[model samples]
Target: MSETPFDPTVLLSDDLLERFRERAAVHDRENTFPDDDLADLKAAGYLAILVPTELGGAGLGLAEASLLQQRLAGAAPATALAVNMHLVWAGVAKVLADRGIDSLRFVQEGAVTGEVFAFGISEAGNDLVLFGSDTDAAPRPDGTYAFTGTKIFTSLAPVWTQLGLHGLDTTSDDAPQMVYAFVPRSDAVVTRDDWDTLGMRGTQSRTTELHGATAPADRVVRRLAPGPNPDPIVFGIFSVFELLLASVYTGIARRALDLAVATAQRRTSKRTGTSYSQDPDIRWRIADMALAYDALPPQIASLCRAVDEVVPPDGRWFSYMSGVKHRAVTMAKAVVDDAVLVAGGSSYFASAELGRLYRDVLAGLFHPSDPESAHSTVATAWLGPLDT
Candidate 1:
């Protein structure tokens, strides 16, 4: 048999790069949703990358999507975040196509109209505080589920027309079940609460409360056990999300590198006659920065391949998926930490680009499935013999 050509679609192209750079600063300073950036993505057909080709989407694999995310994040992390939620929601809609095509239409139309989307999983006091009692949904007798909870650090909520969320349904008798629901932002009230974070400021991640808001049963894609028994593909998808999120942080690091190098090249140190770029210490820092930045892409790519090969129907894929997410998030934390060090004093000042990258990269550490728990789970897997 003849070998198939290696013709995977390239998710990001040179043209997209041009547009991203052009609008990157405006969105960052304005703290507004990058509608122009999203319109560019939709116009280029990148917004629907996860919707499967059969459903009027590009059907790109997770690796390809991750690559695209890194490319976009290199220009703007906030814009990349908005795009990530769109693809994640589109993935959910794709998996639930049997219920209705409306979700797909919602994503598609949102893309066409330059309307952005965001995910709401963390709650106010529990905001990125380990996914505890932040939010929950209750089933009504009418088959509609009522969600009464506040989601904190919800990015793009102020500008999003649609939102994808995960919440617990305490009404269930068995262990708390995880429910994935999609709702229109227009129907829900967002509390314009402050997200005055140190980095990714443009994200405008705010608090939102859903008061007796009901979502149709068809929109609830998966209701799984609270523990470790999630669908493999879903778990793998989240791993991919972490990996790409790491990539975005890496891209931010790369941008910090560029900014540092540019500044160092132009300015000479006051104490030393030599330029900052020529200083041996600065050179070493730059090298370390480059090394850390270089290390993440291949690691992320390897995990993306492993995740892409996952078959959810097969039971064995669960641990592998969890392991991948664990490793990816760990790497992301370390790589972004290196980014902060590489930028040095400038990394702490709000006026410097490095400062922003440092702040945003730190936020990546708080993501679910980050180093602490990921390492714990991986350790548990390794110590399975002792538990027995």
Candidate 2:
């Protein structure tokens, strides 16, 4: 199949990014969602970037989608992070469709029609990461399932029309089977106002209380074993989620590196009467940032292409994807730290972009495929499963 061509530059132009950047701090200060940013992105048809062109979308693949995400993150990490939750669903649908499953076609069609999908998988103390759900998926006589659980870090909570979540159905014949489905916003769902955070404040990823929030029978997309099975739904969500997330932090790294370079050239030492760019230490730090940031984009592109083309890797795909996410976030945080050092005390102010980037980068550590999880995945892959 010929790849569909979609250029992100047209939609996320420098001008548009600047507008997002202008409002980023304001939204962060007020602890509000980036409503205007979402509106503009929606108007630009960006919300449907991953939907098939025949479905009234941009017809882009994961490679292109990840690139666009990187660009978006550079302008506003919080906005990009919030948007990531929506893109995850669309990307998952694309992944499923590519594998000959129309299970999530509605997700694709919904995005085309301007329906925002929020990721509602994260629950407190559920470290099993999709394998085990703390939420209860109580099956009804009509086959619909009512999910009762509180989802934490529900990004896009204020405006997401649909929420894609998972729960364990203990009452089912196959007890403890995981059920993946989409639940539309309703009275049964409650959006908590507690979203204040250290960074990515514009995301407003508030807590969501799903008290008997139900998904229609038709909306329940997948039922699978509650362990690390090789199910396509598992692959789709894990692959897309990790790649898109890595792209965001990689973009943050690029922005911080650029800012550091610019700062070094502009700042002159009073005693030496020379620009900081001339300092060996400053030059080395910039070089280190560049070296770290340079490796991520290509890695993201390659892995994303593998996902789009459905190329099976020689080894497990989960470990590779998780590693990419881990490295990207680690590199981004490092680059931001280096940039702050190069930019000096001025960058320490909360008003400084670098300061915000510093705080924002910290949030990357909390996302799925976190440091400990990534390490465990890799260790298991290389060393084989430990003795039970």
Give the alpha carbon lDDT tens digit for every residue of 114-138 in model 1.
Answer: 5556777766455333233546678
Task: List RMSD in Å for every model shown.
Answer: 4.7, 1.6
Give the C-alpha lDDT of model 2: 0.94
Question: How does each model score on TM-score?
Answer: 0.78, 0.98
**Compared to the true structure, candidate 2 yields what TM-score?**
0.98
Worst 10 residues of 1 by lDDT: 311-320
Model 2 regions lying over 4 Å from their true place? 1-6
Candidate 1's displacement at residue 93, Å, is 5.2
Candidate 2 residues 94-136, lDDT tens each? 9999999998999999998999999999988889978999999
